[model samples]
Structures are given as C-alpha cells and as structure tokens.
Target chain A: MKNKRIYQVAEFMARVLTNGSKNLVTRETGKVMREALEGRIQSEPQGTVVVLDFSNVGIIDFSCAEEVIAKMMARLIQREYGDKYILLTSLTPNQEENIHAALQTKRLLALSLKGAKKPKYLGVLNPYLMDTLQLILERKSITARELADLTQVEINTASTKLLNLHKARLVLRERMSLAEGGGRQYVYKSLLEI
Target chain B: MKAPLSLHEGSFEYLLSQWGQRLSYPSDIVKINLRDTKFIDPFGMVGLIQFGRYLRLNGRNPFLLLPNSLDVLRYLDRMDFFKYVQNLFYLEPQDFTIEEKYLRRHHSDVLLEITSIENTDDVHIIVEKVRERAENILNIHLHYGPMEIDSFVVALSEICQNIPEHSKDMGFVGIQKYFYGKKLKKNVVKIAVMDLGIGIKESLSPKYASYASHWSDLTAIHLALFKGCSRYDDPGRGQGLTNVRKWVQKWNGKMVIRSGTAYTGLIPTWEFAPYKRSSLTFFPGTLVSLILPEKSL
Candidate 1:
C-alpha cells in the first residue's frame, strides 16, 4: 500500500518568496523551494506518493522548472529520498511545456493529471517503455506473469520491462507469493493508482 | 557632453561613442546634457542610469543636465527615473520639479516603472508587478492573450534574473507600452534590462573560451541567445534566453543583446537592422532590448 500526499506548489512558493508571488522563476529561488520540498519528502514514509499540485501557481520559467522539477526527478531516480514517488497535478499548458522541456533536458520522466483527464507523461521515455507504463497504469498493478500473459510475450521480456520501469522509479515493485506455487514474484504498481 | 536630442535605445550608441573617447581621462567631469531631448524610451532611461553608475565606478564625476522638454521630464518622472538617478548622477538643477500639468494622470500606460534587479526577490517582485498590469497593457494594447501574457512575464523574469545569475552585478529594468505610428501602425511594448559588470564573454569564457572560433562578445551572445549556452555544464542550463528568443520570433518582435564590442539577436523584417554586428564601441556588461509589437493580424 502507498500513502498519498499533496504538496501545494503555490503555498510552497508563497512561503519561500518574501513577496507574495505565486510565479516561480530563477534558479536561486528554485533551489530554495526545492530544498524545502526535499526536506518535506525526506520525512514522508516509504512508498509515499507526493503529488505536486500546481493549481494555484502562476508561470514557471525554464530555469526554475529545471532547478525544481528536473532536479527533483533526477534525484528521485537516484534514490536520494529512498523509495518514494512523485506525481504532478493541475499543471497549466504553459507550465507543462516548461516542465516537459526541463525533464527532456535530463531525460527524466514524470506523470501528470489534469482534473478528470487520464494520466499523461510529462517527459521523454522510449516508446516501448511508454507502452509498458501505460499498461501498468491501466491495470493499476500487475505481476510479471500477469503482464506476460496479457501482452502475450515471454515472461523474461515482461520481467525485464517491469524491472526497467521499477529502476526508473516510475512504478513501485512489491514482492508477492504465488498462490499455486511456493515461489515469490514481483508486482509492479502504478504510482497514480495508489 | 551634449546628449542626443531624441535619445532612445538606438541613439544611445551616439552617447557611448562620445563617452568612449573620454574614458582615458578619468578625472574629467562629463556633463550628459539632455537639454533638447524630446523623446526617451525605457531603454534610454535605464541605460542612462546604468551608464552613470558605470562612470562613477570608473572614478569619473558625471553630471546630467536635465532635459529642457517638459514632456520628456514628465515621462521620466512618471517612470520614477529621478528616484534612481539621484545619487548616480549630479543633477544640474538640484531642485527641479514637475509642473502640475506634467503630473501623472489616471490610467497609466506604463507597464512597469524603472526597477532594480539586485537579487532573486527583486525578480519575483518585478514579475508580479508586471503580471498585475499585463492584463491591461499586454492584453488590451498588445493584443496578447493569456498565454502570451504569461510568456511575456516569464521572458522578462528570465532576462532580469541574468543580472543576479550571471552578470554578477545589479541591474535596472524598465518596461512601457508605446504607440508606434511611424513604422508600425500599432502599439508596442519596449523592455530594457542592463548592467555594468562582467559581460557575456567574460561570463562564458571560463567554460567556452577554448571552443570558439575567435571568441568575442558577439560569439558569446550568439552561443547564449541562439544556442542556449550557459557557463555551467549542466544540461538543463542556458535555455532561458533561447526560449525568450523563440517567443520573440513567434510574436514577430525584435530582440537585441549588446555587449562588449558586438551585438546580435533576432531582428524582424519590419526593422531594417543587422542580424549581427561586431567591432563596435566597447561597453561593459550587457544591454538587452526587446520590442514586441501589437499583433499584426
């Protein structure tokens, strides 16, 4: 099971900014806000899905997007915070463009949701991996055997794809015991579903 | 020194040519006389302030003879130019005042007054202040939509942040909307951000010095504006100016960055300026001018 938490970026920006501005610009202010966010993420329990809500926030420039979103994704994949996931919510199209550019620069990927719309990928990912991610998101959770049977692929190829997604920190992997047999298998779950 | 009668970003070069010759004599007091000046834009105002600051740093006592044109004086006062020029330049008439007729009236077209970009907080404030007025000036005057307004503020913030981020010096920024009836029959907004510190060449030299063919201010600026080069090796760096240039082009606007001895950037076809020019008069630091015209269609 994963615990979900919403981090209001507008609130974070207001707390960090001396002036009452919701717009995030410049690397200096970006560093300050990201450090504070990292501190908050550190205190959360393992398997926590931190949703960065950009609902009230204003414009986010490329510099700040790189400093905050790209750097955070980079560190997340490095396991700097240890077994945590991040998702974005309520991003404006302009914000999405800048954040996507920042993520593409570092070849990082993130999942975002807009209201009732389906989850969307915000950064660069191989088409194969993207299709697998889409499958996992649709199923909410799936074991390697389940994925192999659903996609009609070899279990090893399915397992490798799941492992790659897990390595990217895009999905949470859980150890599950097979019901019919005594062997253990890994189950990959989407962060959004949790 | 007698300043140009019609002072603006373009005419500022004439002032620089005169000042460049007088740089050898640091002890001389240069009186920048704007007595006959009729029109002045945000670039000219902020540029004068930065120029004054630069001269003082070089051990020169500079004096500014106030413009005799009441219209120009009123515009300067409306832009709060006196607030910054007080200590930077010795005023000829210390007690000069604006007449009641010249006082600021209701409904200001001034999108943003002359403001300083000293730190991160200042950039935020500048962004917020401009955002507040963007709906009025940017939307109504420039015909910019919500996204365009957002881009305008973001571009402004990114450019202004360059002072604290790379220039290693405090700078001034001013923005205003004007009616351009001569060349373009629509309104336009002019933005100027300038500083007197280590310029683009010096800033990028540490990392990109050896990788260029005849490294110069023009080369450094092209690397920055066109190629998105930054001093840091981080892949995510240096996209600020490149993105700004893209937005400027999309809107059919003009953007120019003038630094040490060279200047370059996007110049729309409507404006008959060189795409790139080098071997000009040497000026410390960077001077950026962006003119976004009202939507043609």
Candidate 2:
C-alpha cells in the first residue's frame, strides 16, 4: 500500500467559490471541483489510496454528487486514474444518500469510512457480489482456497468472485507463495486493510 | 389595471390573464394598481418582478402602485421585495417610506429573500444564505427534522440550479414560512422559483423529436416529472426534478411547475388544483411553487 493522501473537499470548495461557500450543490461547481480533484489524484504516486474527506463540507445535492462521485467512480473503474484507488471518508448521512443515489443511477460502487466504524458500502452492488465483498472486508485478506473452504463453494467459484470484486476496485489482489507446495496463489486484500 | 386583492400562486393566473387582455393595445406605460391588495406571498412578489421584466422586454414600462395597507408594505419590505423591484418597475409613490413607529421586529419567517439566480455562483450564495436560516424557518416553523432540513435545502438547490442549467436566462427565488389557518391548520413553507427562458418543451425537443407530433407544454412536464426525462442523453442527467418530486412526496408536501403553456406536479390532499393543465396563458419561462407543511405528530 502506498501512502494515503487526504483531500479536504471543504478547503477545495472554499478556493473554488469566491464567496467561500462550502456547499456542493450544482453541476457547474461539481464539474470544477471534480476536475481539480482529478488533477491532484493524477499527481499522486500509483497505488495511493485517495481519501476524499467531506466532513467539513455542507450539503451535496444529487446533481453535484453525480457529477463528482459517480463520474469519478466510473472513470476509476475504467483505469482513468492509473492503479490508484478512491475511498470516501467522513461523509454525512445526507451526503451519503445523495452520493449513493448518484452511483446507483450509474451502476457504480464506492466505499466510505467513518472514524472507528466498519467501512460502509455506498451505491449499487449485486446481492451475490455484496456477500463476497462482506467476506473480504471482514477477513481483511483471504485466499480463494480459504474462501472456498469457509463458504463451501467451488475453488473456481471463489476465485471468480474474488476476481470480480478486485475488478470492481473494491479489493486489492496480491500474489502469495504457498509453503507446502511452493506454488503461487492470489490473495484478495480488503482496501480498508491496505 | 387593478392587481388581484389576493396575489399568490393560486391567483397568478388572474394577473397573467389581465396582462394578456392589455397586450393588444400599444401602450408605452402599463400601470398595475395594488392599492386594494390585501395579501401577497413570495410567489406574488417574484411573479410581479418577472412580469415587470417581461413587460420591459416587450418595450413597455411597468409601473407598480403601492398598497394602501401599511402591514402589506412592511411585509414586502421585510422580504426585500422593494430591493428587487426597485430596478424592475417604477413605483407610483417614488418617495414612499415606512413610518418609524410601525417598524416591525426582525424577519424570522422569511427563509430566503428575493434573490437572483444568474449562475451557479448565485446558487451557492443562495444555499449558503438559506442554510443560516433553515433551522429557524424550516425547523421551528415547519417542524422539519435534521434529515428533512437537509433534504429541503438540497431540493431547493436542485430547483434553483435548474434555472442556470437549462433556462438560459436569469431567474428569481424567494421562500417564506406562513401559517395556514384553513385545511392543514399548520405552518407551511412556500418556495417560489421562476425563470423567463426556454421552457421544458424546447429543452426536451432535441431528445424527444420522435414525439413531436403529440408534444405540448403539458406533455413535456409530464415526461419530466413521471418519466425522469431530460434534454441530455446522459444517464445521470434528469434525476434533479424526479428526486425533488420524491422528496416532496415523502414529506407530504405539494409541488407544481408551470412552464410554457402547461402546469403539472404532485398535489397533496389539502391543495386543490388541476393535476395537469395545458393551453393556458403563454408564459415564456418556467415557474415552480413548493409548499412543505409542518409535520403532524
């Protein structure tokens, strides 16, 4: 895991709005802020977890949320920001609802973290994929073999599910060597753990 | 011409109808007498401002005659009605002043003053201004909880953003809290937003050209409210109005939008208006009125 870079949305909004208003509620404002954040994310090293902290931010209406969060998630999945991952942090319930609604409209998924709380999933996820995501988040890191044993599923099923979650950018995959057979296997690690 | 005694969303048509009749004559100056006006809400104020601007654009000077009632004057002044109308219309009593003896208390029921929504920055300023008063007006007056207040502000933002996003012209918005003594018998907040620009029909024309044969102002509004339609083909484009409708319905409020020659929206039990109407006065832009009543115990 590379170093985590925290972007303060409130500070960025203050700079963007001449009046120093912290609310994010328009497509125009959302587009400008998203572009600035995208530029900053591009400057960060690969594999950096970009945390968008919206704690001090005021209201984020649906349009702005769609313009920023949904669009960013769409691009992130397309590998537009390289190998970096995006995590939302310190979002108010109201903000979460708007962001979730926007993401659901676009069929995207994002993870949000609050202080000392279990990471919450925002946006749409298939029920089956959701189940697999919960397992990965809970175990922090798990091998396909271990997942298949724990869930009584086929090895290929477990591997496919893990790969799907990784492809969705919800988990990080790394190669691990087995001590018994001296063979290599893939391990899926929770983004929160990283 | 005489302005309606009760000038509000319900009577806005009367004002428009009167203006329509006078449109045939070529008069350099149009006089709108308000001496008998007893009540005027935010809708009336914004409607009057837009009317004045509309007349000016049509090569006519709009003149407003002040109401005789001091209470009405005070209410108008408190809502900053004079500040906005100063440049739009020529006041009859050009030197009118409020008597110091009847200077009322600070305005607590006004959620937002008459503000222009010219661009996105104006929307940010409006959201900021309303946030400071949402607790007092939306909470204390309308009994909205934290989540409801947040939703209310967000809905307001989305509605105002529509002006600059699609209107292609400047607009105005005003909000006030009033106690409805009839039917609901509770405090309700009224939000009025309007713009004189391309109406919904014109905005949706590009995407819905296939339906051009059966299209009207009413069809455009219905498509937007029910189908979640927009002019843009982007999947994420048209959720603003739909979400606002959902939020209003969830809170048991009433909302009505009038664009071009038609009007449609979700009407609550207490209100009585046509759910959908077309072939009305040919207004050039869109006008929206939302009423969120106090929550029942």
Best by lDDT: 1
Question: Model 2: per-residue lDDT, tens digit, A72-187?
Answer: 99998888988888999999889999999899999989999988788888899877889889988888899999999999999999999998888788888888788996999998
List TM-score per model, in order. Answer: 0.95, 0.96
- Which DockQ-derived CAPRI band holds candidate 2? high
Q: lDDT of each prediction vs. the true structure?
A: 0.90, 0.89
Candidate 1 stretches greater than 4 Å from native: A149-153, B25-27
Best-matching candidate per TM-score: 2
TM-score of chain B of each: 0.97, 0.97
| Backbone clashes counted, model 1 | 0
lDDT per residue (tens digit) for residues A89-179 in model 1: 9988888888988898889999888777788788898788888999888888998888899899999999999998998889999998878
